[model samples]
Target: MEELINSAKALNAKKLVVLCRLEPGCLGPDGIDHIDAFCQVAERALVNFNADICHWCLAPRLDKSLIEIQYSLAGKVLSRDKAIKFISSFEQDLDVIEERFEDKLTQLINQYIARKR
Candidate 1:
C-alpha cells in the first residue's frame, strides 16, 4: 500500500482511489472491522508524506461503496481551496453499473481528477 501511494505521488497524482481486497481468513469477521483495520494502515503510511493528495477506499466486502468514501479537503499537496468531494454526488447518480468493472474504475479515476481540479 505504501508503495502504491509513493508511486502515485511520484506520478504527480492529486488523488488516489484504492480498492481493497483481503484474503478470506486474514480479515476480521465483518466488513466494518476490515475497514477499520484498513484505515489504520493508511494512516500510518500517509502521515509522513507531505503532498496534497486525497484518497478513497472501496471495499465491497466491507459494504463500502464509492459514494460512501468521498474525499475530504485536507491535504497539503493537492488542496485547491475547496472542500472534499465525491466522484459523483452519490452512487445513484452514476450509470456505471452498466459498464464493466474496469470501465467503472476508469470512470471513477476520471471523475476524481475532474472533481479535484
Candidate 2:
C-alpha cells in the first residue's frame, strides 16, 4: 500500500484508483472482514500522505460482476464506467499519465503567470 502511494506520488497523480477482486462470500466468513481491513489500511496510508490527491477503491461485486467504486477516505460509493476507464487508463501507460500531469501543471502555471502579467 505504501508502494502504491509512492508510485502515485512519483507519477504526479492528483488521484489514485485501486482495483481489487472482492468476492464477499467466496472467501468464507472472514472475507468481507479482510476486505474491510485492507480498505482501512489503504485509507490510513492515503490520509497520512497528506497530499492533495484523492484515493478511490474499485471492487467488483461477485454476484452481479458490477464495479463498486468507493472513496477510500470517506467510504462513499461512486461510478462504474468511470472506474473501468480509470483502470484502463492506468494499464495503458504510467509514463503517459505522468507526462500529462506535468503538462497540466505547466499549463496552470502559465495561466497564473499570464494573469499576473
Candidate 3:
C-alpha cells in the first residue's frame, strides 16, 4: 500500500482511475480493510508532495477477497472547454457515455487544449 502511494507521487498523478477485478483469492480480508485506508494514504502523500489533483476509483460492487487495483498519474492540466469537455466534474461519465464512445477522445482532447490557449 505504501508503495502504491509512492508510485502515484512519483508519477505526478492528477487524475486517477482504478479498475478492480473480482475473483477468488485475489486478496485477503485485510485487503478489504485497506480500501478505505488507502484513501488516507493518498491524501497524506498528496499533502506531502503538494499535489493539486487527486482522485480514486474502486470496483463498483465487489467483495474484498476478489479485488483488482490500478493507479494512474496525470500531470496535465484538465481543460474545461465546452466543445470537448467530455467529462465534467458536475456530471457522471455515464451521462456522456455514448457521445464519448463515438467521438475520438484524443482528438477532442487535443483540439480543446489548442483552442483553450
Candidate 4:
C-alpha cells in the first residue's frame, strides 16, 4: 500500500485508486455485508495518506465469464464495466489488469494536470 501511495505521489496524483479482485465465495457466509465492513477498515487504514483514496472491488461473473467493476471517486461513480472478459490464466489475467489500470491512471493524471494548467 505504501508503494501505491508513493507511486501516486510520483505521478503528482491527488487521488489514489486501489483495485482488488473479490473472488467468489471468498467473503464467507456473510457475503455482501462483509464488503462494507472491509471498505470501512480500508478507509481507516488509508486516512493518513493525504490523497483521495478510492477502492474498487472487482468480481467475476462465473456464469457469463466477465468481470464487473464499479468504482467511485468523491462520491461520484467514475466507471462501471460489466463486460470485461479475460481469456488468459489467472497470473496472466492479473498482469493484464495491472497494465490496463496503470495506463488508465496515467491518462487520467495527465488530463487532470493539463486541466490545472
lDDT of 2 by residue, 90-109 (tens): 46443454455446434533
lDDT per residue (tens digit) for residues 19-108 in model 3: 323332223344454434443433343342212322433332355554344434363433234313433443544235424322432343
Error of 1 at 88 (Å): 18
Number of the predicted model whose lDDT against the real structure is largest? 2
| TM-score, one value per model | 0.25, 0.28, 0.22, 0.27
lDDT value for model 4: 0.41
Q: Which stretches of candidate 2 lie over 4 Å from their true place?
A: 1-21, 24-29, 48-54, 58-63, 68-117
Candidate 1 per-residue lDDT over residues 25-81, each given as its tens digit: 233344343445544554444333322333434343433232332333224322212
Candidate 1 wrongly placed segments (more than 4 Å): 1-32, 53-66, 74-117
Q: Cα miss at 57, model 4 (Å)?
A: 8.1
Residue pairs with colliding backbones in model 3 are 13-73, 13-74, 14-74
Q: 1 or 2: which has the higher TM-score?
A: 2
Query: All models: lDDT?
Result: 0.38, 0.44, 0.38, 0.41
Q: Distance (Å) between predicted and true CA of 52, model 4?
A: 11
User: Which run of 10 residues does model 4 get worst, by summed lDDT?
Assistant: 82-91
